[model samples]
Target: MDNKEYKEYTAADFLNDPDFLLWCLDPDKREDLFWSEFPANHPETFAEFRKAIQTVGSVRLNNFTLEEGEKAELYDSIMSDYRALCSRRRLLRRRLFALAAAAVVAAGVVVPALLGVFRPPTETDASPARASEIRLISGRQSEHIASESASIECAPSGEVRINGRKIASAKPARMNRLVVPEGKRADITLSDGSRVWINSGSVFTFPAAFGEGERRVSIEGELYIDVTPDPERPFIVHNALFDTRVLGTSFDVNAYCDSNRPASVVLVHGAVEITTGDGEQVQLESNDMFSLKAGNYTVVKVDPSQYVSWKDGLFTFSSGTLERVIAQIAAYYRVEIVCDPDVRELCCSGKLVLFDDLSDTLDVLSDILPINCRIEQRPDGTRAVCVTARTN
Candidate 1:
């Protein structure tokens, strides 16, 4: 489609177009046309979208109400989708070609967006950018990938490592994200000898080697860093949304693109200066935090132990609302959690144990929080569970 034609289209237009919506929602759509231009910048919105599709795929529509063998027909329909996806790798291997634009070898059978092609849109401010923009992602506003130059360095002896290889002075590669998903995490030592423990769902990217300049890295999700201090090369954590720059410090960043209300940076030790994507900047002392909320940032002094208890396998929420708490639990334990108005309205204080299994944590919460809850299998059974209840 031409730029003129695409400009006239609205999100609602394609949303209402069943065929287009299916293509948009098609888990296999070519990412070149959509994914990078749309979803890459808006993780939360995409997460919700994937959740809705999962809901639709698993929703229990009464097939038993249909004619005798109709139930089997419905089952077969779902099974066919599974089989098709399983055959993707095999088919991709068989009919593959090299493209000039995409240097990487590809089958060209799987759609681009669905296979993980991400790109920024052309018009940065276009509300709900066209499906084929180049710079900005619609839905959620994120800081653009700013500051491409940051170097790495070496301290005392060995400092950083990459892909199982150790470097005396580590210079991270330039990338938008360093995805260390579950079942995997990264361990890197900075020139300051400060170690970084990257959790699952985390990303970290920097130059492969730092030079005669500042040490800087950009990231998202969650990471625990122990900085090795070089008075000259200050370590800076840069994100489109917020930037935390410091020299020789330890801290954790949870800028998961989860919410706009507040992007958090918890300082463990030393001093750091935080700058927001909006150009707002603040300096945080050891044990203090800079939280970006609603165009403004609030600095709060906190205990380092609270921010990093997750490293030891305990998740804690100090006087946070139910929604944020559930988000943390869902990510930590890897489950979809939804709360009712009442449950969402509930505010939780103190701590919760995640590694102990879901039932134990639920038992502890239900016992103390005056809310009795239970999980029920959805009508359409695709390993879906919903938890609901009210204050006793």
Candidate 2:
């Protein structure tokens, strides 16, 4: 069945699907991954899909028997509940607008207003500078670091230091945002003693001092973090796609919002619980890598060091495709890289130390592989790197 057809499925439709029955009866790893991630990809059908799963599980475990007449009645009941939920949501939306309107009248304000009640929560105010600079933003103040690579320290007292010099002092409850542009990186020590290595083209939003409950931070792009243990309060790393919760763990998260690449989390030590966009939860152990690509997800065991080595100025891979390797390099340097089709699938295994100079790194790469690299300047004032088969 076409995957898109599942979006419009009802509980009855799911219950009648042969593939769904197979998934419940004999679960395959690849099938399980697809089914588990289905609800996350199609959130509007989550309730119906969950109801179907529960019904199947109950019948299998409890040996529940239902006649055809009873089955029809159950499907009807499920549809009625779904309709009621939709109605309630519409009513709540109306009520919210009413409240907003009443507040505006009471304030004696006649201004036009656009209420974003249905908008998703995001760090919309934190805007990073250009790719050539690293910026730290707190409240109305923005500080730009002068170095290509930077060290940032956040004290428990809400004091921020950049490259060993005091930069800004924030309130305990205030939020601080750090932006690492392309071709640059930053190492940060949080107030809770946890350490985070921010990669190029990343934005990290965190509180100066964590509150009484959870130690939460949000990110866009990639990061390698070693969280400090606090049993009383869990640490949560939030992205647009999922949330990673851990008490104390070292993990690498590659969650760049690029459509061509998948978002992944690789655990180095300790354990973590991941909650996807549609509220599905997944648990991972040490060395477990969870990858979500195009709404489907898989969990696999891998050498965690291979994924986290970028923080150490190295690109470590084993039989990685040339196309994938070049993609990483392009993102790191914030340059456009195009690979000829013939050489794109070439496989190689080794380590490349990412040098500060792009030309130097390209030279090493050319020496290791049968490829030629050329840099060209575009009219838009950006550079592009083209890779092709070596003529030699």
Candidate 3:
């Protein structure tokens, strides 16, 4: 099916599609691409598409030739459960929105695709080449690191090494920038033993070693940091919009400058003081989530573990928006994902176990939400995934 026709498919439609069923049973790269791309293109039915895929996968119909009556019965049973689950979901959503709006305000896009019309190239159609790359810049020397992850370790001799190369000496201080692009992540331990876990699509810059009186690092995108206990010297996290200072604490900072996505600081433990560019300040104790968007800051109580779970490859979303979930998946997998504005606010609550394969994660997402996913390759050799509302 073409993108437009596929956009009209519902969960029942996908489940009844013979080609879709066979692809689910034994998929090739082409089939994989189509399925992965479907959810990104049709997020309104993204959750349902996932359910259909899962139902097909779980059913062992290929074992034997079934009679027409038997086939009908099996299909009926599956649909019954699917409908019940969807019903429960609708009810659950009502309860979740009441409680989660203040705590986990799900956030992220626009517009309609005219049938049979070719969309002229726009900014969104650009190749997602940066998704698969990571860049490191030290002084005037810049290099591309080819790995899914990067790590910096402090030697027993007080030397700071990145990916096993000693990047800094003991006495003096030097600044280094580490940019983990959309499809990768990194971990860095400073000379002072403070460790930072950088998420995908993030940029982190820190000094080689700690100097007297203070430690500071600036980041764009997302990071989970564990600041070593040093009562005399405080650690400060700097971003374009704000700065967070702490004595000895663990916190997560997500400050992506690409879009209006709010810069947020979620404290896992200890205490922090956040100061915005405009000098507005907010103090957060343990388990406080502070978000700043459009120069306004809001604080809410939340379970810090849910916010920082990405560091462990476990994504926990409690009534989170589909837009945010898709964005996280896109960054984690280094794929381009576009969601229709219509379905961006669809709330989903679930825990996803991430695998190295992007398709596997999408499958989990599809199973959790009524969404379809598909992959499309651009002329520039980069792949993009489009998500939209599934057709009735």
Candidate 4:
């Protein structure tokens, strides 16, 4: 049977799963599943359990106005610079969207093949190629990647297309970043027929879509990739902070810019090369986890299972410092974490699923670690602090 015809993992599997496909695709639902325990595949899933919680807990409710306030602010900020131009004028100049007045739909010219198109998530302003168009729909968050003549097809091989042009093909890649939100993750099959799983609150961009050549893409945040076996492309990852070049492997990278030290790359299988700007370069084989600091590269042998924990649909932290654990949770949940030095230095290693509330996460972290965490209500009314009081 073709890959499309295959019975895949069901919706229920993804729903109860912290790392299940559900949480990766929808950011809004994460808060609902953060603390609930579901079946876990490995230590990695354990990590994501608490990670999901910490992420949601970090959402600062302070100073958050209603959606209407947000919309008004957006309009105020852009109206001056956008008052001109016919297309721009109609959309915002008349507040057409607010008035529920829109008629840009292309009737006859619209192609049937263009429906339900999926484009890559964009950072900040999605400045799409001048030739192509990717727009945000009103209700659903999918970037409506509409192109006139270009037809997009996912071959039996799971390869994707734009029109007839092959923007990404099977190939080894160097720098690939595919970003997924709390409720979304994308499956990208590499040229060598390897599959890369991008986790939520993470991005996986690879030359995996490359033609017959070396593959690469720079990434920010977390990702899980199963590299296709290719001697030539030797799938590679490039971050402004670090680099990982590998041949036929599966691995994960936690290399966001906010990371205190260098980003980390952990290999589950295959051979790889990791280079840190601090002049530290090393080759990693299976079961190796490497990280870069300002100028230092640290390599260690890991269970490999820990690195690919996100792959199992959960995140787990081994006996790590409280600060370190919190950092990972903060990024996943997209929240700000604050802890004093005394409590921050405390070490913790335990298993918990992602938490939906910061207060709840704080309670759990406090229960497991030698600290008491609480939210300090600010003058603005929304509690902003995840204060940790050292028990020691």
Candidate 5:
């Protein structure tokens, strides 16, 4: 294919391309170099290319043996089915290709049960459900705070207070969990004087007081933390994929544990050393962002404000695609947002103040971009914001 043709290819087009299939099936050094450089050369098609790669990589062919002739026959059959399906419907082509790819090289009969293509979307696949209130859990006791935003304090004496009212008193070493539901935010002052601003849909676990050894906390969503500088006791933040260690510095950690999103750490100041699940350690300086995707780590320089601004009820982006911006809004408000694929890749730049009302924020976004936003009810009994190209 020519450069223009390759640049215009969608995920489905890439999956059905003979050259792409050859590279996936029988990779050579030349093809590896070419595919690796394709994204850099055609930035517009990078997302589609990445989607194709992930779809292909996730298919697992198990322990089925087939004769050479059988393999050839099965491959031809799968390709024929794929082509027939492609000609019928464009919306279902990717899912059909996934099933075809699974049985193409395998000798056994195609089994739809073994493929993930037919699986329904799980809870993680959708926007997190909005909880009625934030819950703080300590041992068997749970405290529910009904406020839109909450401020919790943990005193050195093992006393916990929410919004200046004493909630619970426990041992200094007792572990406590704070849950911030969607459409809300919270700030917590740890016993050691370190403060953390937790974002929506986040779960933060920390001890009521720091031990003599090291201060440690674990988070599943996102948070902006300012560590109390104590060289003797380094502060560490743990997530599913990696651990970030620092001393007396501020940084933003976005470890949402979502397959579609990469876990990243953005350093606002000071420095941090990240230890991956495989024990690979990387150090980051100020204004540096470290992102981990598919077991690989990448570091880049970015404006710290673009990431940490959420702590101040602001969303900032520069040349960010509409798809990503909508994803962020969906997570923040716990609202399902569906952006038209035709306009998903459109890029915009601006700062948006996240108002309490989601519509207010959407209004600002619609004004900034050439898009129209409307709320619609999905078949699943939930409401969603649908974004399409502006007609007027």
Candidate 6:
């Protein structure tokens, strides 16, 4: 839609536009810029624009495709509700205008007083946003799946379905892989009722349904899982260097390949047995963290918050080096951070709530430590943050 037309478009108009619907379905950078700018420039229609967005989000969450008649019925129902809400608001606006006019007339005031009584509204403020699209690999074909499009509700009577089609039941022919890239996270519920929180830059692969003997899945990077209990079928998690076996339990795994640090698993509840590729085995209890460095394995007691807090938008650092801390930040925000040699080895301890923009996080870090952060534009026209020690 052009700028002139966008200014006058109603919520229904936006919902009817094919381009607007496509943007709502698969929002990329260009769509994001257009919608963000549209609201800012035409704040009077911001509420209506948000209504359209929410309506589309609700519809997208249902995995099944609606027939033409069913789709029309759904649209009519939504529009009916919107019309009711708009009617109520319009009545309130009329009453307010009446009251303001009476007051202005009594005071013999016109322009300034009326403007003060009814000021123009501004665009709604939005918080920091991270696109969390999951990539699914089925056989040789791969597709990016939006969170709304991926179905999580368990199907009835031993059926495994995704996007309204049965993919597995009792026996499965192939394994399906799901990937969550950097700066994004995803929550998925397996066919067996187990829930998984896949962290950023992680890969997980599992069958569509459980087999007769065991339930098994493979992983790369990190995952926080709450496995379903079934003593008959043991649940197993396979990683690069080790395998975590359990019947029913909750645990966090960190095995990102890019990190120089040791790969570790932190158990929150129940019991888990970790077996290394080199024939080493260890059992962990609650609040236990098993770390694998090189070919050696070690177990230690640690606070579960330090390992599992990322699911709640937190980066907990307990006596960590500056290099490791910066690496974590770079991975979380999908940004490049170049740390000077002088400051890479500086050790620090703090809890960082990662709810704000990346720049805000860097500002807080610079304030607490003896470092300076600068955004540098590289020769390739890309930007990265360079962190150097503050010289006196």
Best by lDDT: 5
- Top TM-score model: 2
Instruction: Tell me the deviation in Å of residue 335 in model 1.
Output: 4.8
2 against 6, candidate with superior TM-score = 2
Ranking 2 against 5 by TM-score, winner? 2
lDDT of 4 at 134: 28
Cα lDDT tens digits for candidate 4, 1-392: 01221122232233333343233333235433542434242333454345544443333212323488878876884574355534553333223221111111111112232212112222332122111232222122233333211123334333455333445433232323333443233454545566665544554444423656666665655677777677866677777677788877788887655534456888887888877766567898888888776766788998865456544434455555556666655554454566565555454443443433445445545543456655556675433446455555
lDDT of 3 by residue, 254-284 (tens): 8765453567999998999998898877899
Question: lDDT by residue for model 1 over 278-347, one digit each (tens)?
Answer: 7777888889877776677788888877677665334555445655666666554344555544455455
List model 6 lDDT by residue over 1-392, tens digit each.
55446654545456546467556654568877887687778897787789877655433111336789989986996586557657685443332322221111001112221111111111111111122465666677565654322433333233455444455343354676777655556566777889887776677777756667888898777889999999999999998789999999999988766435578899999999998998778999999999998887788998997788676445666666776677777766556777776667676554553423467557656645667988767797544788877884
Candidate 4, TM-score vs. the true structure? Answer: 0.52
Error of 1 at 193 (Å): 2.6
Provide the lDDT at 69 for model 3. 98
Candidate 3 Cα misplacement greater than 4 A, ranges = 1-131, 142-144, 155-158, 162-171, 331-336, 340-347, 355-357, 367-369, 379-383, 388-392
What TM-score quantifies how close candidate 5 is to the native fold? 0.66
lDDT tens digits, residue span 34-76, model 5: 8878899889889879987875574443345779998998799
Question: Model 1: residues >4 Å from true position, as ranges?
Answer: 1-177, 182-186, 318-324, 331-336, 341-351, 356-385, 390-392
lDDT of each: 0.49, 0.74, 0.66, 0.48, 0.74, 0.64
- Assess the local accuracy of residue 366 in candidate 2 as a C-alpha lDDT between 0 and 100: 69
TM-scores, in order shown? Answer: 0.48, 0.66, 0.62, 0.52, 0.66, 0.57
User: Which ten contiguous residues of candidate 1 have the minimum total lDDT?
Assistant: 97-106
Error of 4 at 381 (Å): 12
Q: Which of candidates 2 and 4 reaches a greater lDDT?
A: 2
Candidate 5 — which residues are off by over 4 angstroms? 1-130, 345-347
Query: What does each candidate score in C-alpha RMSD?
Result: 20.0, 25.1, 14.4, 20.2, 19.4, 19.6
List, residue by residue over 1-392, the lDDT tens digit for candidate 2. 43547655655456546567556655568768888888788898898798877755433111236799989986896576557656685443332322221111001112223211111112234333254688898999989876667778898889998866797699989988899877667889999999999987789999998888999998888899999999999999999899999999999988876666678999999999999998999999999999998788999999997799777556766667776678788877767787776566667555665656577567667655667989889897767788877887
What candidate 4 gets wrong by more than 4 Å, as runs, is: 1-177, 182-187, 276-281, 340-347, 355-383, 389-392
lDDT accuracy of residue 190 in candidate 2: 95
